[model samples]
Target: MPRNTLVNTGLNLLGLDYKPLTVTIAAMEADTHFGFEQVSPNEKEGRVMAVFSSVADKYDVMNDLMSGGMHRLWKFRMRQCSAVRQNHVVLDVAAGSGDIALGHLRKMGDTGRVILSDLNGPMLHEGARRMLDAGYLPGRADCIQADGSCLPFADAIMDCVSIAFGIRNFVAIEAGLAEFYRVLKPGGQFICLEFSRPVLPFLGVIYDTYSFHMIPQIGEWVTGDRDSYQYLVESIRRFPDQKRFSHLITQAGFDLVRHENMTGGIVALHRGYKL
Candidate 1:
């Protein structure tokens, strides 16, 4: 059986209903942003999950084709910022296809533990499959289905928490950051890699055209799903810029917060610490 399958089974046996609880809590709040539109917080997760589930099988391929393999370089930059130690414990939220988790594993020697987590079961399954194919020992990394706003782990247990291109999809970005902060050990790092406002003057025009037009077209051609990728592009536009997001990180009780823009600010890597 797949690792994610075991994790899900354990969740079921424990009767932990993370999704509905998160949605219910979010629904109690005011309207939240979902892509370019304002939607009930309860609706955002379902919509995001739908998108991930639809693309799980082709996610890796789409990443390569969409970014021309630049995402690998971007993630490598994130790893450099992470400075993961050999025996540290890392939690990768919204792990997706496990690219970030795999990088963490490579740096974290045999004793290190990497928890690959995602809210969508299918995506976690896909991530686990990739981990196995990469020859990762079964115990070196564990798969978990979890909510970013409400991680099941106890406080101050993780050495580092890293999220890539995933925070923008959260119903409540602050809430998710708070949860991430809660799980980190003292002086632990929180590294977020996400799309940011493009800095180059004319690049925005070209990027917008490609995102709004070519992206959905590519999604339709590759995954037979256009709406999901459309949402993806819109969400990038809707997400807060680097300075604003760094502020959010600080608000979540992380100190020494800072961010570095990559590729002329098309993407940014935000770093903070629980001091």
Candidate 2:
């Protein structure tokens, strides 16, 4: 039941070429989902970290190009739902490229603090660099390499926790939600902006075709990494719909859970309060 043997079995079944490697099956236990397939918990984390590391340099520009700037609007909408105030302490988990953190900093004025964290070191470094380049002083924001499921902060300390387009990548999303709930103070807000199932049937069909077919090509052109983009598309498809995701928020000790669909449900903004 070695990992390589399992992979080779699949290749043999599918009539595809197989390459040998040293990774063991003990590292993959079929206990978690990585993209659309089940993988070991440890394997999923390494794979996800590798994906972000591979794309860190070109992530921002490629995001603008791929989403046609709609990601900006989505982040803006997430910020609006945050209702952040001056002196608030916010945590932006999986804050790749610092979009949500930057938006929160602008609203927080001089006294607020935003911590940008990601599992991938390169992504966190890139986000911190972007914050510095934008004239945000070192005091206004801090960057840390951390996992969403196991946040390193104290309990009930953050005023707001926002994650944009990052939750679906979690190996154990419910664990992440629990961590978010634990780190947020009573009455604090949790906002998530992420890809979701499209409401319009026709649009969903077209979106699926374009995402599966064109996105990898775009990723190749932009970052020379098609497999990473392919994983992203598959992960989005495998994420729960809004209703189910709302249930998860409630299960994690959040109250007043609600979600707003945007761009015909191509993306959604989910908000909840720790009460």
lDDT of 2 by residue, 86-140 (tens): 9998889999889999999999888888888787777878887888898774667
Question: Which consecutive 10 residues in model 1 have the weakest lDDT in total?
Answer: 8-17
* lDDT, candidate 1, 1-275, per-residue tens: 12122363322322333333543275338888778888887688789989999999999999998888989999999998895899888889999889999999988877787888888898888988888898774767778877777777667788999999998998878888998998899999999999999988999899999889998999999999999999999999999998999999999999999999888888999999999
Which residue pairs show collisions in model 2?
3-25
- Poorest 10 consecutive residues by lDDT, candidate 2: 1-10
List the candidate 2 regions with Cα displacement exceeding 4 Å. Answer: 1-30
